[model samples]
Target: MTEEKRIPMATIGFTTEDAREAARDSFYLDELDRQAEIASNSIFHAIMRGRETKNPHDPRVWGALQNTLFATICIARLLKPGPVREYPGLTKQQSQKYADERGEKLRKMLDVEDDCHILDVKAVRDAYEHYDEFFDRHLRDVS
Candidate 1:
């Protein structure tokens, strides 16, 4: 058998604890999605059966128009988590790994040198600094 060299792989920045934390977050998000979908489907089914339009803006037949507000909220939460990513349960290793991968992708995305006068190293640095702001801005504010 020939000996083969293997590269040392860096962790994705998630510890077992971090993985658990992420898993919890993921579970909550999934549950939120499920509940929202179910409510939407119910409203859709009701409107279909009723076959009456309360308002042009109102999709449902003559139900309390206010209920639509709750439905809209569920839909919004499904799309965006609001500002709730605050608080704790965040891990440094996990954060670092996310930052590294995000940085790498942003760096690799630059096709030309000095597109922003960024050398490869500078590119990674720029990407690193930009990632959080980019992520935050892109983060769904309503959902």
Candidate 2:
């Protein structure tokens, strides 16, 4: 009888964990994009309905507006890196220094308008992370 032929399994290039992680990352990125699009659509609908009814305080309008802001904050968080420390371990000066350096790098990369710099987005993310304190401290300057 002829010897039986043997075949080896082929490598598809990625390990199992690597493939899983890649799939998770893709899902996360896609979800973020989906949420951003929904928020943008909500904003348009809210404004249009408010204008038509001449009632800016309508519940749907207000709810949609709030969701839009929340989604914007989420997008900002996704764009920038997370804080180095979760707790308040760093001094105010050190925190500011870190933010400045990061902001500059982001600005150079984005090349966006001055008002919409990464630093501004980072500030919003910080507020969401520490809402009460940050709001009180920089309410006027948050714009």
Candidate 3:
């Protein structure tokens, strides 16, 4: 019979918890990468759809632009230093503040000289997301 050799846990220099933490970190990074790739693909599809129509006012073109905008926002948020979190109780202003902080962190990390324009998409996103309220406000103003 052949003898089997095994390394002791002490020689490994890391606890099982450390391994678990590392695995969790890796999984998080992989998930972020996957989401970014999906967003990129959405942007690519949007570009292709936009190219298919010459009229900017076309519904297809508008839809594509909307997708591109949302995708860009996703990518921008992904660029932030840590995992994204959802604060269900946060108000709109608080949420915007959090986003601004994340964007600033990313910009600083990247050594960007100019403002991160991608962060500015929140207003456009909000308008689209709350289109009913936006349209109602506009109608009220017009009346």
Error of 2 at 114 (Å): 11
The lDDT of model 3 is 0.62
Best by TM-score: 3
Candidate 3 weakest ten by summed lDDT: 7-16
List residue ranges in candidate 1 displaced over 4 A: 1-15, 52-68, 81-143
TM-score of 2: 0.48
Ranking by TM-score: 3, 2, 1
Q: Give per-residue CA lDDT, model 1, range 1-143, as digits (tens).
A: 99999984433346688786566555545555565566567667666756664455654542432343345454343333223332355576655555444334333443322233212233343455477887888895949
Against the true structure, candidate 2 has what lDDT? 0.63
Tell me the number of clashing residue pairs for each predicted model: 6, 0, 0
Model 3, C-alpha of 55: deviation from truth (Å): 3.9
lDDT of 2 at 24: 50
lDDT for position 67 in model 2 = 79
List the candidate numbers ranked by lDDT, top first. Answer: 2, 3, 1
- Relative to the true structure, candidate 2 has a C-alpha RMSD (angstroms) of 13.1
Candidate 3 residue-wise lDDT, 23-105, digit = tens: 54454445556655766676777678778878768777566567667665665564542344456888766766776675565
* C-alpha TM-score for every candidate: 0.32, 0.48, 0.49
